[model samples]
Target: MCVAADWRRLYWWVVLQWVVGVATSGPCAQRCDCSPKLPLVDCSSQQLSAVPEGVPDATQVLNLTYNHLKTLSSRQFFSLRQLRELDLSANMLTVIEVEAFVGLQNLITLRLSRNRLKIIPVGAFSGLPNVQFLDISENEILVLLDDMFGEMPSLQKLEASENDLVFISNRAFSGLPNLLELRLERCNLTTVPSEAFSRLTGLQHLRFCRLGLTALPNNSFRQLQRLQDLHVSRCPWLHTLAVNSLIGLNLTSLTLSHCNLSAVPYAPLHHLVYLRYLDLSYNPITTVLSGLLGDLLRLQELHLVSTGLLHVESGAFRNLAFFRLLNVSDNRLVTLEESAFHAVGSLEVLRLDGNPLACDCRLLWVMRRRLRLRFAGHAPSCVSPVQVQGRMFQDFAESEVARTFTCRQARILTRKPQDVRSDEGHTVLFFCAADGDPAPSIIWLNPKRSVLTASGRIRVLPNGTLEVRYAQVQDSGYYLCIASNAAGNDSISVSLRVRGFPASSRNRSGSFFLDGWSFASGQTAVNGSQPFPFDVKTLVIAVTMGFLSFLSSVALCFIFMFFWSQSKGQIKHTATIQFVPRSSASTTAGRSTVETGRFTMKLI
Candidate 1:
């Protein structure tokens, strides 16, 4: 009877343990929330140290965001084989054991962003065969090793932005054959090797913004044949682009703004014929040379804002037949040549504000052509000629332009004296004033007819004043002031005479003059003598006087010929003759006698 009672008590204890196990494993655990209707689990922000265990096996979506989960063991999701989406974002996950996602064969999307993961071990995602989207952004990932995602062949999009990724192996993305978009913004990568994207032929979009890269090799994207959009912005030190950097890709839109480039790399850009949108803003490119963008036949929009551009060559947009939008604002352009926009006849939107534009006749073509340009309410202002400054280009009148913006010929407005006197070792200035349509260039020719350049003691002021500091006896000769422009050229002459010493005593240097009329002693002067110089100013004056005298003589000759011809035509003719007749007496004696007297005529 005692043995029977012991067997009975042991049997009852075993039955009670089975009942507790069955109750705890039904659809939910102590901290996790489960829904049997939709087969979903929500264990987020639970402050749990590990994944709750009693989640339903039929759960297709798992939400574990904002949790204190520290590790992902290999059997963490072993029961959720039908899990299609998993969210572990904003967690303290530091380690993911191998085969951590082995049973989730139907998983399509995984979010591990804002985690403490520094490395992804091989085969970490080996079981998720159909995973299409993976986001590991804002993590501490240091490097991307080869075959890191080799198990997920169906992965279409991957975002690993804002990480500490400094190196990516050549075959890091080798198995991702269907990836369409990859974003690696704000990474610590210094360079993207030539074979970094070797086999991503189906990739349609790629971005590498704010990376620590300095250059891009020619073959960086040689294997991305179907790439449509590429963004490489905010890379402050990225300046170099090889000749064939974008040769093989069929890109439709490319952005390289704020990369600190000094010039537009036209050689590599010429290969992208199918490009439609291009942005090269916030660079230091100075000039847009002709044919630089002529090969992009189908190009539609171009952005060159704040690029420090000063000039645009005439044929810069020759081949952009379908171009619709052009932005060249915030540049240093003063004027666009007459043919600068000749090629973009189909342009619809044009942004030209924030520039120091000279609104003269050169820009009248835009108004006359009646281009349907959409300025977006911000018009460019003129910055030249004082009268037209601060005026808009569209406000210029066509009828008044010829009278107001006429190309005037350069002429001398102020002339220096025929002869100037200066003491030895003194300063002398010769003045010349000129006026023209386009500002004329002022040049000074010395007595030797050689062009004078600014030197130690010789300087040309902005207003065409030649200042000779410490003038010596050898500087005593005719200096010419020549002002020239596209319209014409004018010149004036001034003879400089150093008074105080003869030619032989010039080198003695006893007492010299410091000012034009004062004398000083014991002062050192430039000790040299110029050769016997040719006075071009004197020759010019002589030729001009001769020409005027010849003109005067020709006028006199013409006046004399005119008067002689008038005198010949104005001769008056007068006939003074008296006619005497003696026929009356013959009438009375008709039969007797008839006499006629001879008449004498005097002409005066």
Candidate 2:
């Protein structure tokens, strides 16, 4: 009894649903599905050779994709006055008779891709004036005649890629004054159709790809004033861009990928001051030369992936104040200099993956700001210096950089000190300077190979200058100056000969006579070798220290007075600025998503 009751309820519910559906929807063709409320008709993949009967007159959107219809006869869709979108893609359409679309006055989009049409009827598209988007790609269109699409005055975006389009007449695009975007890819254009492109004065975006073009001649895009984005990619023979090729346009986004370019066309791009995005990937460019991009001040994103990039010379990105992203991946780069980006303070994303980077001092700024910089994709790792090879820059501690990234050695910068021939009682000085990482320290050694300490007659200043006040005979001999650091050391020698000192009175340990006086084995010898008191030398050192202290105090007092007076007379700021050899990020107009060769980039 319970099962019977449930079956009766279920049958009634089904009957009610069927009645409601039929009443709401208008009469549909036996082969087509129609919804009166939505005003839509779908006959896709029906394998029909002709239009089915009983299609509602109120249908506004018609889909006939994947069909077998070969021809479109006159007035076939004359009654569908309210149709706004028509898709006839993936069909065996061979011919379209004149006036085939006589009543579609309100159509906004028309797709006729993947068709077998070699030539379109003269007046097939005569009445579609309000169409804004048209796709005639992947067809056998041989040549575009003058005024072929002149009737569609309101067309804005047109896609005609993947066609055997051989030649385009001078007036091929004469009627599309309002067209903003056009794509003409995979065509048989041996040269740029500048004459046809000149007619598109209002075009803002253009994509002309897969041609046999070797170069873009001067004034190629001179008439495109409002143009912004341009993609001229996948041309193996395109190796050059004429110096004045982009003279009169302000493009924002540009893609020149998959070309045979040997270098960046920084000369032609000098006119694109408003360019914000650029893609030059898959080229054979090896180096980013210095100041090559000084004019692209507004450029924010750059793509140089898969280029055989080896070097980024210092100042390569100079004047790029608003740069934000740089993709130099899949290259043979060893390292980029920090000084190269002194003008790039606002860059945000830096991609260095798939590169053989040597984590040296040239890239020290990157490791120092590892946390702050956003390294896109894999983190940059060292490919050299055995100890740090294959290790990410972020994996090392801040202190480790100082210990690892070091110079090879310390080199003495000055020439060898000249031999000094001074009379007794005259002062002598020897100068020595060096260059090294962490700065080298200076020390002096006597002829006896003993370190010389600062005292009454001998001293080494902070500037690495050896000063000996009141030089005597014993001071005559070889004086060696050495500069040393953590890496290595360098030394130079000077022979000091005192005129009045007798060599016969000198000892084997380099203790020579100075006016009948010498210090041998910590003993003072006078004439016949007798011990002497150290009171005289000690008194002279005391007097010299007191006098030097007095001068220093006076100098400080004068300096304070001068500064105080200057403050009262004129005000000065206490703020200071330092220019360290460092580099970082910048800003841009906005963010977007663009697909490139199967790789999608989310610009920030």
Candidate 3:
């Protein structure tokens, strides 16, 4: 009896421990939140297939990210009324039925990024009135219908970047009137319509980076009064900006990078008086005008790199007084003007490298005078030739301090009379030359310039001379030649004439060979047209034919002699055998015959 009681007690204790161990192991069912402490429910990275049920009603934060959940039905998440932060990022969610989040009224932070959602049905967030932060980035969202976010009244931050959004319809974002930060960066937004963001009155940050935007409407960003930061970077095709396109925006940091702008427009950037950071790098801007940087009073950092800027107009940058970090590297500038760095009194850490600098007296003066105080030790070195084609720029030492280094324009080789028209088969002779530092190319004006050449008859001589043996009537108009060097172009034209057949017929000879008549003045006419006569060619052909005929006769005579000698003995033997055969046949039949050796018939 004692042993049985002890065993019962031990068994009860073991059973209680097993029950407690399973209760604290994990979530009790699907979509259940079993965070370690503080009513925090984290079901992320569990590879959950279904929306887990049995989540604690007191759950404050629910994390369902990094899962393979396909769809979010309306009733799946209805129990989590107390949930505030919901993370469903990095999932395989393809479709979200309308009103999926209709009951989550207390949700504030909602993340659905990096999913496979192609389209967002209307009223997907209809019940989430208190939602402030919403991220739907990195989805296949190509189009946004109007009033898409109409239900989220309190939504402040919206990140819709890195999707395939080609265009946004007007009033698509109008429902989010209280939104503060709107990010459309890295989306395939090619064109932003003028009224796309018309109703977002409270917007402060608008980011559009790595987008395929080519052109923005004239007043696309004009209405955003409270916009502070406008990020437009890594857009290679945004080559032009209309005046006042960005006028009204109170931007603090503006980035316009890797664009091919060659000149700063006359547009007004002064409207953005609170601007702090401005980046305009990797462009083709070659010149800087006066008062260009004067408008950015509160600017801090300015980057102008690889801008193809070779010239700085006098006192171009003498007005930017408040800039801090100035980066002007990777340009084609040969010299820095005296007052270029005299401006920007608060500037610090200026970088100038990878530029084609002319390190002459003018450059040395800038180094000695203002460089130690402004540029420090980050000045670039010269990249051009000290001695080009055997001439040294340093040899002109006297003019070094005042010499101006200007970029010589490339002289283009062009075909003169560029617009050429003629009847087919018209021959033309073209000439090409140049009138600049480098030679130019001259050529014919076809789809591509092609030279007129004929084998053995047409020849291009070593000295650029073209010669033709006989000009045909088809070869009547123009021929082209292309000559070029590094400079610009000049072209010449040569007119060609080809004799045509007329109504009356004549011969090639001076005297009409066909009619056996000699005309006066040594005139030669063919088909009623007078052409140049060549007697030497005719004489040469006639002499060659006579010599060939004589050789042919001698060959025939030698062939006859060789055959006559081979047949002489055969002829004699054939005659002797003819007589012997007849005599032998008669003797066999008992008839005799005699053969005579000689007979004299000349006596008669």
Per TM-score, the best of the predicted structures is 2
Candidate 1 off by > 4 Å:
1-42, 57-60, 367-371, 376-604
Clash count for each candidate, listed in order shown = 0, 6, 19
The full ranking of all candidates by TM-score, starting with the best, is 2, 1, 3
- Please write out the lDDT profile of model 3 over residues 1-604, one tens digit for every residue: 2223533654565466455652333354565556443456678888997677777765656788898989998756787787777899999999898889866878778999999998897878788998888899999998888889988878888899888887787878867878888888888777765587768888888777887767655777878888888877778888888777786688888878876566765364656668888888887787878776666678777778878877776666555667667677878776565556545446566666666655543454444334344554554555544532232233334444344333333343434453333322233333343344222333332112345333234445444445544444544555555554322334455555565434264344322233444467666332222243334456579899999999999999999987987887743322222223334333436766555343323211
TM-score of each: 0.62, 0.65, 0.56
Q: For residues 1-604, could you state the per-residue lDDT of candidate 1 as single tens digits? A: 2223433653564466455543222557668786543456788889988887778776666899998988999867988886777999999999999899998888878999999999998888888887888999999999888899999998888999999998888888878998888999998988885576876778899998998888888788888899999999999998889898887888899999999889988888887889999999998899999877888888898899999999898777876778888889999987665465546568777788898876555565555553377776777677877888887767767676665444566788876466888876567888888887666778988887877776546667877888887676778888899987545789999899986567565434544322334324554333223222223455568899999999999999999987897788654455445544655344444475545455555533
Return the number of clashes found in candidate 1: 0
Model 3 regions lying over 4 Å from their true place: 1-33, 268-271, 341-344, 358-604
Query: Candidate 1 deviates by what RMSD?
Result: 31.3
242-315 in candidate 2: lDDT tens per residue? 99998888899999999999999999998788999999999999988899788887999999999999978878
Candidate 3 Cα deviation (angstroms), residue 586? 99
TM-score result, candidate 2: 0.65
**Selected candidate, larger lDDT, 1 vs 2:** 2
Better of 2 and 3 by lDDT: 2
Q: How close is candidate 1 to the true structure, as a TM-score?
A: 0.62
**lDDT for model 1, on a 0 to 1 scale?**
0.78
